[model samples]
Target: MATAHTHVTKQQAPPHRAAELSAFGVLILLAGAFLPIMDFFITNVALPSIDTSLHASAASLQLVIAGYGVAYAALLVLGGRLGDSYGRRRLFLIALVGFVLASLACGLAPGVGVLIAARIVQGATAALLVPQVLATFHHALEGERKARALGLYGATSGIAAVVGQLVGGLLVGADIAGTSWRPIFLVNVPIGLVVLLVAARIVPGTRSEHPVGVDVPGTVLFAATLVTLLVPLTEGHSLGWPWWTWVLLALAVILGAVTYGVEKRAERRGEVPLLPPSLLRLPSMSRGLVMVLAFSIGFGAFMFVFALTVQDGLHADALHGGLAILPMALLFFAGSVVAPRLLSRFGRAAMSAGAVLQLAGLAWLVAVLLADWPHVYLWAMAAPMALAGAGQSVLFAGLFRSVLADVPAHLGGIGSGALITLQQSGLALGVATLGTVYIGLAPHGASHAFAAVEYVHMGIVALLAVGVAALPRFTRATPVTPVTES
Candidate 1:
């Protein structure tokens, strides 16, 4: 009996287990992932409440959301580089802990100004937390096993977005034993503690042997270029067109060109760079990043607009808003779980289909909202919402793995960072552009604007499908590196 018990304990260890992850390892990491993704979306549903409680203006509110996303996007590459340089496991643990503390700061913030500041820090910590998940999965699981791990990760991410929106609604609506809207952020504490315990016990330590150091100059340039572009776009709605905004945007373009040239020079000189020149040269990575930029723009804006349409325009309240979004969230998760199987077989065809399905959903939405308007209910909207969710599941899963497939191991951190940065920044821009169009049309009133938003959605979705169809189909279906034994 003693011998059997000892063997059982040994079997449970990450390295001692299969080259594949055990259910426990995946579950623990999933829990760790939960808070970061949840925080991103949940805040959207809670935004109206926060605005009311803190007396924030529309610009302040936009900053509250933009602050987190921009900071997260800005730091992600460097954060990924830090993990690769020191150790992924070490950075992961540090980030998870920081996220918890930051969550506390966010929940306790007394005013709109303080809350926005706290949110920016929280987003930076989240960037540190998220990249490690991808790196760990890359280092820990093998072949189909690695694919499965990524699939689960993508599924969890999609689910979290939905969960954030829904749970945020529930918490704010319930007042949660009189805790009011604060519990949405405060809820991260206990979960973080449990995740820390599990991760310390289970997540394996991994790092690149010849890890490329952070490209300090490149990182600065990249961050500066993106920030100059994003800050104006995010504020464009409120600020209108300003000469300074255009000037900053032109500077961003010039800086982006300069960043690329510097990275190429560094690569030729045998120096480690933030985004290695060699990695950028990969046709797959280059094309993949472009698609990420465009896909994110549409998807990001839709979610923001959807929230406003349901709550502000329709006068539905938090609980109703959550319920309205539930179907999309559920269907998206279902699609993500199955997307790898489809991609493994069909490649770009699978992606195209996903976009088509999503477009169909948008078409349905355009028709329904135009016809139903103020009378639309949770049930009536479920079909289109579910289809949209399904579409996102496919898009997120395919892109997540596909983007990383061609990355050289040495440049993994910056490469991963660049991909995610494109994703984050692009999504922010999408919300800015699509959101601008949606709100620009809002003057025609909610129902008409809702119809117009779908036009933006359809155009974006079609454009993404065209982008995916242009890629090397199954070129990204396989693993870039063998998943290491935990």
Candidate 2:
């Protein structure tokens, strides 16, 4: 149950003045949404170059990846709460500025330690900035406009993952005056500066009227739980599954229980818990998260594992490795652009179709890879990749809308935060688990290992398809709207 403190606060201005977002404002928000996701995947192809340059061990390399991801995932809910309490525009600019600086630090770091430290800060700031984009859209847009805006957001997400790798490959190949992988992070500086300028001018400020109390104990316990779970998973293979790994995993379970207890207590006290347990009662939100976890696991595993397989197994150059995914990326963009229109007609059928297509693509890919093996080139992989990308585009384009269809506007920040938290967690866990599986098997043979993982991913896609089939279809009568604060 919502507390007495949860009522809407007085508006700073008239309602209409606060309600609308200009077109340029939407563009600026999309840019904000795009960069962080791109950065997440950009480093994939560059990891080998980084290891060579820094002489870093396998464990340290995993840290570089997991440190950014873990911090981002753990703090996302708190980040959302901060924006909800403060002004979203205010927090967004602050995080963006910090993101630019962190990128610079990551670019200039002399060693793995410094790079890892800088990346953690980078991810934390991303946690702060990303939710604001969606929350802002949820608040400012309505009806068809909202659907369109969300489709863009979904498209941007899929595009960034592919582009990150593409850009990483290009930057590494260009060597940008012999700086090599450093240029990938440094490239964000100018783009960020531009985004900050536009955002300051156009991004309207909005926050919940209700005063939100910081749930400190809940936040701490949540962070501890994620760290314990993610760290051990990410590092276990590199560290040879040390005794501490099992200890940390066990600790994660205890921390999770303690977190639940703390949240329940906060609810009894009529306080705003970090992630309101009550919100999970929303059936659409709950089911959508399940689909998010399943889809993201497949998506995340595909990107990380594909990069390694192409570059290491096939001995493809960084440019070639990045280009290999281009068909999927292009088709994904097309599918995302087309999905909003389809949703109006087919509703949840689009998602089911997407799932089917993705499964088909995976099956096709596995067969081709198995048949072609060492002889496979970018062209040979293009057909299945395009199909898979198109399918992914359709699935993600509608997922956010389906999830938030029932969420109230007042809880937009927390809702968006919750969605992204699950997404990042899925990504992290996918890498930790599937990545470990592939990495473990690589010593035997790279192609065979990659093919083995593809089969596993096929099963994951099939499971996600079943989940999509179960989602309630959207209808004209069930229009998507922002939930107003009580």
Candidate 3:
């Protein structure tokens, strides 16, 4: 018996050590994830300053936001494929360097055109950087460690948007030697440099065992499809709904069909497509992706509209606008930290509960706004915002887990890419669609516009709650031990 126990211990020791990702290493990976998302929202609060400093038109400002989002969404799958074929750590380091360079260009840009171009490049590099974080988590950790790491990732994502607004407000308000909006982009420099340096020493290298080459035709079609779809949605209203915008929207649908057909044919021919059709066939992946899209749309709309309402409607400064959302950010982090425990106990029902909580919070917020109208204090909205934040964090963590749970390890990069692409696209769409509505109605009354948007948010969350009921119950299973590379 003693000899058997000793033999088993010897066999288990190496795998145990191999599975360990140091706390610092995990932090570095999470930072990489945080920067890209934060950059997206940071610019929201800085737009006014940018307009003043650069003398940019409303259309140009919209382009600045759209360019980054379109590039990021279009290239994400390619980034994932590159990481799988090349090396995740190598790609991550390279992308981080590129992101920092692009940030510098944005900060130093003398004209609106240059800023737009730089933002696009920044978004492209971000595509390369973000997927690697999720791939690493999938490849390097498992069991309880994996669950906790994912929870932290969810927390990081949820908080980064609010932090972006807060940090952007602070930096812009500071005027940092009269630099105005420039510091928002420049802020990424030192942080990226430090993370890049530490990541080189700590992050384990990983890649697919049977890596495939890039699918050229599929890449072009996919890029074109997303450009047609996203460009119009993001820029249409700002540009006064031109004929070209409608044309592009129509083209997007046709191109989307072609892309799907092309991908299906490639799969049938035993060729690797940019997006593997087989991956979407998994019930969990498909259902979870739909949930992610719905949830993200509401989240995106809320952030954008709330910022505008507080600043433009309430006539609050950028600093005060950011402060108003601080409670939500704090509660979101708290909920995310405890998500793993919640999941272990309540399973899929936890997601349902979260959605209900979010709906309740939204309803409360709407009621408060209706009562106070133009005089509503920011603090009056804090409790509901905190409740909504906690609920969102819980649902976000659950959806992330469900989406990736059944994805084969070899396809982790693509899966992560797909998940994030939908998320980013949904966010952009939210800003475009509901943002247009709010802008149109604002001329009548800010309070009415705000309440209408919140009502839409409530409807979205209600749909999510209903969708959660359809998800299959979670079944406890033994965790797979992943093999990590150095």
Q: lDDT winner among the candidates? A: 2
lDDT tens per residue, model 2, 1-486 = 556235322222333325488888888888987888898888888878898899987667667777787788887777766776787889889999999999999999999999999999999999888877876776677777876676567778779988888889888878888898899999889999999999898888887655366678987888889889988887899889999999999999999999988887786666757766777568878898888887777778788888888888888878888888888889988886787778768878887788889889878887787788878877988999999989978777667667776766655545666777788888877777788888889889887788788788888877777787666667632322221221
Query: How far off is residue 67 in model 2, in Å?
Result: 2.0
Which lDDT values do the candidates have, in the order given? Answer: 0.75, 0.79, 0.77
Per-residue lDDT of model 3, residues 90-168, tens digit only:
9999999999999999999999999999999999999888878866776677777786676567678778987888888
Which is better, 2 or 3, measured by lDDT? 2
For each candidate in turn, the TM-score is: 0.89, 0.92, 0.89
